[model samples]
Target: MEQDVSAFLGRLAREVRPRSNQWAGLLMQRMRGELPELWEDEDLARVALSETVDHVTAFLDGLEHNRDVTRAELPPAALELARRFAEGGVPISTLLRAYRLGHVTLLELLQEEAARLTDDRQLTNDAILRLIATAFAYVDHGSEQVVTAYQEVRGRRMQRRLFLANEASRRIGTTLDTARTARELAEVGVDHFADLVTVDLLESLLRDGGPQPPTDAPLLRRIAQRSALDGSPDSPVGTGRSHTYPAESAPAEALATGRPTLLRVTTPDAPAPSTPDAPAPPAPPGPPDFGIHSVLLLPLHARGATLGLAQFARDRTASPFDDEDLLLAQEIAARAAVYIDNARRYTHEHTTALTLQRSLLPQGPVDQFAVETASRYLPSGSRAGVGGDWYDVISLSGARVALVVGDVVGRGLHAAATMGRLRTAVRAFADLDLMPDELLTHLDDVVIRLQKEEAREGAEISATCLYAVYDPATRLCSLASAGHVPPTVATPSAGSRAVDLPDLPIGPPLGLGGLPFETAQWELPEGSLLALHTDGLIQDRARDVGASLTLLSDTLAHASRSAMTPDEACERLLTRLLPERRVDDVALLVARTRALDPSHVATLHLPSDPAAVSGARRFTTETLTAWGLDELSFATELMVSELVTNAIRYGKPPVHLRLIFESTLTCEVFDTNSTAPHLRRARTFDEGGRGLLLVAQLAERWGTRHGREGKVIWAEQALAQPHLP
Candidate 1:
């Protein structure tokens, strides 16, 4: 009975072996009908046929030799097919079911072959039972091996996906720049996740933290794109190029619905659908073909808003995407979305703050007679946002110019606002012609008041200021600091040196009131360069303040020796002193000292008597005539007469009269009297106050300045042409 069954089984195997190719073809056709996903692609179909043929050949040989099929190695084709299935994300259950269907077909073929060999029912039944047992053992062993191969590849694939996700999370959004963050995501995708990756964001989101309005067609700007394959055209749109997506496109659909869309291309000629989770649509027909087989379009949605879209794609050389790939892509997109949103918000805030700070700063040339000035203001890098550093050239009375550089001790809108306020206050005090030390004292008080106001909001306000006044008449620069760096002065003859305030006290920063500020006076020569800068210019993390100061001094000395213009000197200093990535705001003000021409000024000592009034008026007329400012003679003489009379009447000892010719014709009277005359509306019968009132009415501008010796009552008349004769 064993011989008869074995002979029958051997006969069936010999008959099946020659027809194995035909049997494998029939088996693949049946499996394709039941398991469509496994045979979706031509490559997969080929792998399936090869695996089927190998299984058929091995089974027939085992039956013919009565070999122990259960202990045999799985066919190489079977193991390869299993790996392909795993990579393509086909389920193990589907593969197992296809094997079961193949087994059934094999049994039917075995019965037909057995019937062809013999007619005895018992012999046929016995041989069929033995053949069925052998087939079962073969299928069981092949299924176990195939499953092991699939599981090993699947496990490694999942681990790689996890690693990609972790890498994306760690590297994205390292800087608060929208474009950079997008590029980071693209790099991670190309390195580990996809062959081609692109990040596209709505124009509105990048411009102003606003959502794009809904439309039939969606537009997205491609901010970044990366491709793993060299010389491969990954995207039709280049970086920073904007293109509109059709309403039915996967990217548009994903953006509109704020969901992820997975697309698989089964055939080159098949009409792919644009719907989510459907087959991929053919890309626009043109040159530079993408040859893409799979794509995942995911909307970058975060914090209850959709910001943009991220696309991951694979070419024909790679496996088509599946459910597992879509899930992994979604995970990475979710993390990237948060980072992109953060960067977008930061960009908006930084832009707004910087704009406000720039607007509040002084614009255009200061055009002061005391000094020719140039300035530069630079905000900190993106990570720190905008900071509150300010510089100004304030035109003061008596041909004096006030150079100011200050820093608010924080960043963003609040600090900028504080800087604006402090700058306004300084200008106001400057107009009053207060001394540098006294002006800073008042500024300190203002800062204290600001701190008090903001304290209730749980915000503290602190600031530093350096105020310096340059007087052309005296060629003296009086400077005072409130916890700010000293200014550097470079001369034509002497090298650059930081102003020494050894005996003078550099008071505490503003907001700390009750400290008296001291002023230091330096007589800078004409053509000297004075540099007033915030601590940002001379304080860096990599270098000590002393070293930075020395560098600044050296650069300034070189600039001065080179005879560069104030503007050129400013550019040179900034280029040399500034770091590539600025961590703090920088404000630099460079001024070239200019002295009033001695030929334009006339000074005469006078006796404290009524006779001096006429002499002063005569001197004013002569000086105006000599300077070719005859047009202002009448007004200048009358104003000079009134000021000289007031000084003689209210004075004690010697008086002085001076006339200056420059932008305007000025007449000044100096006396021992310390009291300053005030402008008042004179009554009809009051002859006493009319003298000062007449002076004010005749002169374009009139004021009184007090000095250690006494007081100076001065008045200026407008000149048609301010040039010297």
Candidate 2:
């Protein structure tokens, strides 16, 4: 049976073929008779049907080729089968099976025919050609059967390729943002012989150069290249045949007319000859000979500027690109132009902001004042915005110094103006050496005056300011605050503390109507440092300002061990305090305790006793000797002796005396006397009346203070130390 079937298949190869419709009828009849009992798998049955049809079509194609060659004879049934197979939709898989079985030579003959069909020339000797290698797969190339199959498989592959190409283009666009050179951009269009040049005029060249840029002539600039026939060049780019791109060929004309242009150029140089014996030099590089006819140039535009253009050569193997592709390129160029401009503007603004901000800050140290200062102002990372916070270190007479930092209410120029006004006033007052409360009250008046001129709400200009006067000689800090953070004292032995303020805000902010601002004072001990700042240090609306202060205190506490000087400690704390997204400005000032030799100042903490008085007087005398104030020590000893004796006799316990043995001896006695102790007239006969009179006579200056806990009686005597020249 197999031999008979094979002979029949051989005869069928030499017959005429029918169309697919009649072949379908014959296959259905054959399926019913040969495979009725095996009809369980509907899916498998469909597969068999498709396979059978493929083989039948291959057999019919073979039969036609045989008729042309051998004029072979065919029996009636074989002839009918060949005709039916052609009309049927046969599967290639089944035809391949039949070829392997040696039933026919159809596969070989059809393959030969397909090979001859390779060259598709719609026109012969056509002088002009325009082809697109990519377009051929889409519209014109391949047979009906092959084209259909390609639509199913190759079409999907093309879709995926196009998607990836679009994504890559987007990424390339991102990479080209702000790119200024043609070479840099050419790396993006790696496969093309492309140059990005600036277009200044419709008929002229531009001095500046770039791939995508702004141009005044939005309609006339163009980009162009040589055709496949002409070939690009044998230069570093391997695209062989070389052609000249005349300045005239620039699509400036087409763009000026609101149209696009496509042209082709032929190169003067021919492919170099190769030797028969030697390995041929690489075929002079050139565009692949796919029968390209012309080059296409498209104009780019954005923001009413011509910008530049894109040029590409058509493929010789395919139809030339048409209006659709040109439109796509134009769209791509438009998007690219906008991106370049935005990037440039952003860079310019960023640089400008930094410059303006630095200009508004204070730069140098003031003389006579030992000041340690630092400031940190961070702008929001967002585009086009800034804030205002500033600081000052001012110098004054008598070895006095002032620290000032304040934050204006809002942002931008208004806030900056407010900051400048407030700082200037503080510096002027600092020169006056006004006490803290007096200075703040004066500042309030200035703010009120400025508010009247600006016509803005005084409430809107609200700010916090802390002023401290540091006297290096006395190691005393007379401080006052106006709605600002209080100064903190960090002692070598006592750690850190916020110095207590006994009064309400040194009167309600300067512009607000309020009376009587009181100044606060503290005996800033030797080895004690003070920290002052604005509300920006501790206040945030999201978290309580108090909590921020706690955090600050903790940071300052930890910083004490590692930092070497007041400046170093302030820097450490500032770095931690200004984290990202800081909503306000920060100013910090640190003043270390003025160094004093132990011999110059004698400290006396004595009980209110006649013996204690005597002890303090002896300490004064001995301290004077050490400080070389011996001559003055005699006067100091007598004055201190009398004060201690009076406090022991009728004054209170817990007397304190500090003998500052500088150019003079200052005898300060702190006693529990509520009464303001006085120096009365002493007649020649009254020895007790003469005690204080003797004190007044011996010292340069003497005073008494009625403090909260007790009264302090103090006197100063000239020192014996040699004067500085």
Candidate 3:
């Protein structure tokens, strides 16, 4: 029958795949191939059946769910179980009768088989008994180790859980949705479960990483307990009497009881228990196995919230775990609390930052300027995108206005504060009636002082500023830059051109001194638009400022020239010009010159429009008022008349009149004259030659330039003040 069953088993194995040597060997050995002929006799069949049962149990032990045992090592005893099953299985009574013989009891036989399948180190019976009873079986038996393996694992797990919970609580929009308290509890449970056993109790409990723990008190505690031990209620490391327990029991007991318990046990081999918290009394006289002793329990709670409790004990009649242990547990609880609170605080701060950022950005359009204005501000992405970028439109003295935009160095509150200061300074300077260049110079001084003060306080900051004044009446914009990108102009007639108002960055970035500065001026045409921006708009990975500028220029050229409103234009340009992420902050201002349409001609025709003569005097005063020069307009007319009279009489001219209107009035009379006009000293009595001298004295500036047509004599005069007579 045994041979028939063995053949059947081999045939079954072949159905799966032809049996390999390992399987073949197991089958051959099961057929009593390795046993003596004497033991294989008919009467020994009962013993064989009994041994077959034992082998079946061992085979089951060797079949681990995970990587616990190797198939190469299935015992010869296990093959016999397979053969017995293949034949007629043995009865329970038959196995018991065999066990009653000198062979090991079922428990001992199973333990031996377990040891073999698990590949555990071989040990004597006494050692095996001690191992099943105490956790020391898992720990190295060093002479000086204080806490048992169980105690150490518990402490470390508790600490780890608290930490993980705290982190989850702090983040905004966290992966865990539960309340901080509950989440923290859950975190503790999950970490501990993962740390202790093959069974993933903690992960299973948090399947889907559940939102913070439920407020249901008992349920939360159960969850915590389930995580602490494989859902067992027994103590993990210590218990009453010298009887031993499994290594996964200490936290399980604390979790199940919903209360903390201290455990103390005196094994037969160690010293006696002493006063609580004291070292265990000296070793008792006996073999070395009897010295185990005291234990202590402490619960963790904080801010009226209870976490879980813990239990700890010594192994060799050492001092009982005491207040020190409790105190440490309490410390761990406090640390856990702090971790949770910090996590929440971080979440709150992040949310607040986003809201403030949205609120602080400019909301609507600024009124009064004629240009189709647009602007873009980009903050650094790494930090909360908040920085000191600003733009403002302020109404000045006349129908005119001041447009300002600038960025401060750095980010956050400091940059914001600097931006505010510089903006206010620009308005104040503009109010003082200083021209753009002079206003920028004054601001440079202010920046320098600010930097010095900041440095003394161990804080460093630097900034750049650009100031512009727009006169609506004259349709001109005067600009001054302080180490800023020169504003670009896109004219209806001239595609796109950047103004050449280059200067060494103003006042050494508002800190360092001895910086030289110059101002550049350009004639703004009707319907011409200008864009002023910070370096952030152009910054890229090329590591070169020029490269960044080229990229910016190219982007601007390709940008859609849609007929959108000023705000929309700004939004579109910004959306298209900037990269998705920027390394620095950007602030930009766009303004266009309002269009101008002139009616009728005001002309002063002269007969014998001579190269050197004078009909210009009568023409000057009368023609200017006709052009609405008024008190504001008188200065340009008088200077123009004088220069024209001088050129016609002394020098040469076809004798023509050219009027250029801007914030200041400019008048020139072109003559076929080759001599450059010079400002020279005239004696007080010199009348005729003194005409040009008086023109110089009365006008803001007077000069002569050889133009494409001829030598043109020009003079500039400030417009009359508003309400001026």
Candidate 4:
């Protein structure tokens, strides 16, 4: 029976071998009818046909030799076809079904051939049974090999998708800038998955504290877009420009429903409906022909709110998106949406904080006779948000001006509020004509109290401050620091250098009590440039403080070479010393020193006796008339007499009087008395208590500043314009 079966199989192979092409064609036609997805790609279809022919030829050869079907090797073409199916996104089940259908068709054809070759009923039955057993074994072996190949390719594709998704997640949202984040998302999509990608946020969402757009037809601003094609033409609506999607467009539908929509372009004219039977939505507005074939429109939904829309597109050269691609795109969009939303929130907060900071800061240029001043303030970058850096120019008494620059420890709204409080406190302290060290000491107390108040909310506060007072009358600048960078001074003879304070030690930063701040005085010549800045100007992650300070000094020296105004010097320093990426806020205050002209000043010594009061009054009256300020004689004499009489009566001896002519007429009484006089309301019967009170009332502004050996009681009366004779 075995010999008979072998003989029948040999005859069957002889008849079937020449018709292998015909049989392969038949099998392909069957596959095309039942498993149409496998034929979507023309290249894959050709591969399938060639693989079918090879399989039929191999089967016939094995039958002719009567080989063991179980030991037969799978045709390379068959394995290649299976891999193509996987790569082409055709399902594995479809490939297996094709194999089963081929096996059944081949078996039926072999049986008919066996019967035609054998006339004996017993021989035909035996041959049919042998063919059935051997064909089944051969088909089983081939199916296993093809399935293995399919799985290997599928596994690699999955890994690639997974790696692309992870790379997108790692690279996106590295910065808190909305535009940057959007660009990152676009680049990731174009590099890994899509031929083109675009990110469009609602116009209102980008505005600070703006209301959400209406859902019917939302207006979107294209923040970022990218394409795989080099030198791609600009989109119809460029980045930063706004456009509205058609009401029934895929993007609008996706946003309205908060669901992703996958569209396949069946023709060049328009995008096909998401579902085959459903009506097509309106085409999205864009350039006439981008050759886009597949589009995935994902709403940027996060935290239960839809913020914007992200679109991923594949051109004609790329394969159409499948269910698996949809899944991956959703994941990428989901991750990107979270970061975009975070960036949006950060943008709002940063704008608000910066606005608050700028409003609280000084608005215009400071006009002072002691110095020509200009200032600049910059908030931190998006990642760090706005910080608590501040600068101010406070006009003090005695032709003096106070320059202040300070930095709170942290960032955001709380730090900005803290900065406002400290600045106000500094101005208030400055009004009293307190020394630089004394003003900082008072500011330190305010910060300590603020910390105590904020401690209940689990927030700790600390800050660094630099305070300097420039007196035009003495050409002396007294400066103090509270853990802050020292100011730099550029003199006519000497180059720029940081003010070195050997005797005055730097005190602890504010919020730490019990540290005494000491003052250091430098005699700045006329036309000297003084620069005061927050540490952000000279400190960064890439360089040390020493190097940054050197750069600052060099820049200042370069500016000092020319007759650069304070404003020009400020611009030069910022251009030279500021880093590309700033993590902290920067505050720069520049001032050019001016000495009070000797001809504008009048000075005299007074004897410590009652007779000297009349002489002092006469000297002031004569000086006011000489300076063309005769109208101020009466008020000036009254103020000078009261201040000098108090100094000689209740204060120490060696009284002196000086008159300064400037924006205002200043009368100062310097006595070797450390006791500061207080302004008091006189009683109805009081005679001597009204001296200081009268001085305060008559002068535009008055204050007393105590020095090491004496105190200065000064009053400024506004200079009235002289009438034309």
Top-lDDT structure, candidate number: 4
Per-residue lDDT tens digits for candidate 4, residues 1-725, read: 79877977887898999899999998889878988866877877888889889888888888899888778788898998888778667788877888989888888888887777768999988888888888888888999999999999999989989898989889998988789988999998887588888898887787645437457777778899998776443345568777777677667788898888888766655532232123444444445555677788888877887778888888734467877888888888888888988888777888778889999899987656899988999886648788999999988887789889999998888888889999999988888778888888999999999988988899989999999898898898898999988888787776455444345567889988998999998788898888999988987788899988888887787788777999999999999888898877899999999999888889999888988999999999888888888888998899998998998998887888989887788899998878888877778987668888888789988988877778899998886762211
> What lDDT does each candidate get?
0.81, 0.50, 0.48, 0.83
lDDT of 1 by residue, 1-725 (tens): 89988878888889778889999998888888887867868887898898888888888888898889998878898999899989888888987888889988988888888988889999999988887888888889989999999999999988988888888888887888789989998998887568889998887776667766545555567899998886554465668876667677666777788879897754544232232223345554423455667788888988898888888878734677789888988888888888888888778878888888999899898755888889999887748778889999997666778899999998888888888999999998886667889899999889889888888899999999999888888788888899988788888877555444345467899988888998888788899988999888876778888889889988888888899999999999998888887888889999999999889779989887788778877877778778777777887777777777777787767888888776766777888878778878877887688888788778787777665578778777666755532
RMSD in Å for candidate 3, one decimal? 20.9
Write down the TM-score of every candidate: 0.82, 0.43, 0.42, 0.81
Worst 10 residues of 2 by lDDT: 124-133
* Poorest stretch of ten by lDDT in candidate 3: 195-204
Of 3 and 4, the candidate ahead on TM-score is 4
Clashing pairs in 1: none
Cα shift from native, residue 477, model 3 (Å): 3.1
Rank by TM-score (best first)? 1, 4, 2, 3
Model 3 / residue 279 / CA error / Å: 50
List the lowest-lDDT window of 10 residues for candidate 4: 271-280
